[model samples]
Target: MRLGLVLSEAGSGLRRNFSMVVSIVLVTFVSLTFVGVAALMQLQIGQMKGFWYDKAQVAVYLCNDAVQNSNCPSAATTDEIAAVKTALSSAPVKTFVKSFRFEDHQLAYTNFKKQFKGNPVADYVTPDILNEAFWVNLNDPNQSAVISEAISGMPGVDAVTDQRRLLDQIFAVLNTASITAATIAALMLVAAALLISTTIRLSAFSRRREIGIMRLVGASNRFIQTPFILEGVLASLIGSVLAAAATIGIVQFFIQGYLQTAQRDINFVTISEAIVVVPILIGAGVVLAAVSANVAISRYLRV
Candidate 1:
């Protein structure tokens, strides 16, 4: 009987302030949408870090015939190549270096051209003119500096380049983006909370006389307060649910459909992953509403 009365009062309150309920729903929707986007952005950053970090490699370029040096002999000598290979295979760094090898200029140019098929640079670059480079796969990409330091002055080696540093810079940018999104979401959520509180206060204000009469009769504090609190909670929760649905729809229709098409390699988390955030959002909204309603009723209850 208590539950039914509370529910009926909640329904009556929402029905009377229907416009305010709509506004609350819109605000909650907007806030939770940002929260969902922020969650997906963080997920993407993690995915990118894993994908790029695992595939990172160090490229070691060798001297060519045009370069005049005894170690290179204007070109990589048989003994020079052999010595470099032997050093790589049996050096102190061997355990860390998964494998290292030489690639002819022609093969290097072929792969490079394939990547830039119609570009102007592709027109000028050919395998015969390019310098040969040795590609090194490491057991750990983060140890690029150590690997480079070991091979820098070795015979037949002209330069040691580690691509991992470039990836680190990119990862830093992703981290910054994630932080910025989180900050924005935090501010918006606060704004939503305030709006919800104000809306609930106004709704409570309209029923003040009815509440006074209830107290004048024989109503207990809990009996009067429970219904109002439940109304606020219901409004907030319904708003959050609407927001979650809209967020999922927008992501599925726009991000996965368009942005992903343009950048095929990037796989953003799906709506299912983003949906995990809904329960928290709804809970927060409900709690905020209930607390706000309780505070507004406290003054009337005391008087």
Candidate 2:
């Protein structure tokens, strides 16, 4: 019941079990770091999906004179390209097509070169060999297949590609990575719980004789158990704080500092999103530690 005594006991227990305390802290930090990473990964995926889907376009490629495609009987003429544009702008197909932009062979080649600037193969291609295309923005991204089908087999079209399909594949990979992180986080949490329980058990057994003396002095189980539980809670709280700091560093350095500059076109989870997860991880760590400690004390210390 005495606050000073309870705090003194907690301090002594932490000092006596310094190594075990450090282990608990490190384990909790790592486990919660994985948790945060998994969350951020999901956030990243969601942000990307929203960003890309909003700008989804179907590319209807025109035939290149130098290439033979089943969809292209011969090189598409300017008139055919014009006809495709007219179709996209008019009623039958226009309802699905929000708008369209034409990329000539030179523009397509320029983009390709920019995309693969360092690749050896890029230098070998010429604009004449590249196909022009209509980048068609759809009223609804989910209707990409409909737009692609409508444009396919048209006189000037060589291929009708849906950007949404490509984006889906990319998102699928991100989702898998998120799942992997969550799996690792779950496994590490199990390990952390075991370690926390072990730490509490060790702390109790080391002070068993003292605990017996306290019992003889009419101390209740709650009073006897408070310090040990507090020890675990404090260690876990420390670890959680460290984990939050690490998470912030990752978002700031790797994501904002590096990736944002390196991949300007890609959208990612903001620093605010990363920060929002910190309290959740901290609360989880505290709860996890408290539960593990209580269970261990009840089992080993008869409390």
Candidate 3:
């Protein structure tokens, strides 16, 4: 009987402040949508980093000269190449250094020409002018900086380059976008919380006479409070469900079909993963609304 009465009161309160309830729901829905997108984007960033970084390589170019004590050489002798390989294979860096090899000018030029065969630039350039290079693969690319620094000053080494810088720039852009979405979401969430508080306060004031009468009739604080809290929670839950539905539709239509087809090489997260985030967002909204309503009602019901 107590629970029934509390629920009836909550429903009546929501019905009385329909406009305010709608506003709260819409605000939460919009806010949580952005929050969900940011979360998914962050997850994508992690996935991309995992996929690409593991395949990243550190290229150590060798000098082409024999007598050139300078890192740059006209040609590298057999002994010099052997010494370079031996040093790379024998230390702390050696554990993760999976393979290392010297590529002569001819072989490097062949690869260079092969890659640009269809390009207009290919007509203006030929393989003969390209420099010889050394390709090195590491077991863990994260340890590449250590290897790069170690071999940079070594004899017969021309230059050391790692692919990680490119990956960093790519991931940085995605992270920025994700952060921006999260910021927008947070702002909207604050606005929604304030709106909910205001709405609940208004509802409590309108019901002031009824509440006073109920208290006079021996109604407990819990009885009076439970209904308001439930009203706020219901509003938030509706918003969460709306946001989740919107996210599902957007992912299914915009992301899975349109964006994926347009950017064939880029992989986006599956719709199923996106749907999973909805519950979490909804839970957050419910908690925010409940707390805000509780705080707003406390001052009004102090009598």
Query: Each prediction's TM-score against the native?
Result: 0.84, 0.94, 0.80
User: For candidate 1, lDDT tens digit of each residue in 1-303?
Assistant: 388878989899989999988877777777776776677778777877788777788887777876656655666667877776776787587888887777888788888887798899889765666668778888988788877887788877877888878888988888888788778877877777677667666776799888779879989888988877777678778877886776677678877778778878767667777677767767767776777778766655676
lDDT for model 2 comes to: 0.89
Ranked by TM-score, the better of candidates 1 and 2 is 2
Candidate 1: what lDDT?
0.76
Better of 1 and 3 by TM-score: 1
**Model 2 CA deviation exceeding 4 Å by range:** none
Highest TM-score scorer: 2
How much is 13 displaced in model 3, in angstroms? 2.3
Number of the predicted model whose lDDT against the real structure is largest: 2
lDDT values for all models: 0.76, 0.89, 0.82
Q: Which consecutive 10 residues in model 2 have the weakest lDDT in total?
A: 145-154
Ranking by lDDT: 2, 3, 1
Q: TM-score of model 3 relative to the true fold?
A: 0.80
How far residue 56's Cα lies from its native spot in candidate 2, in Å, is: 2.3
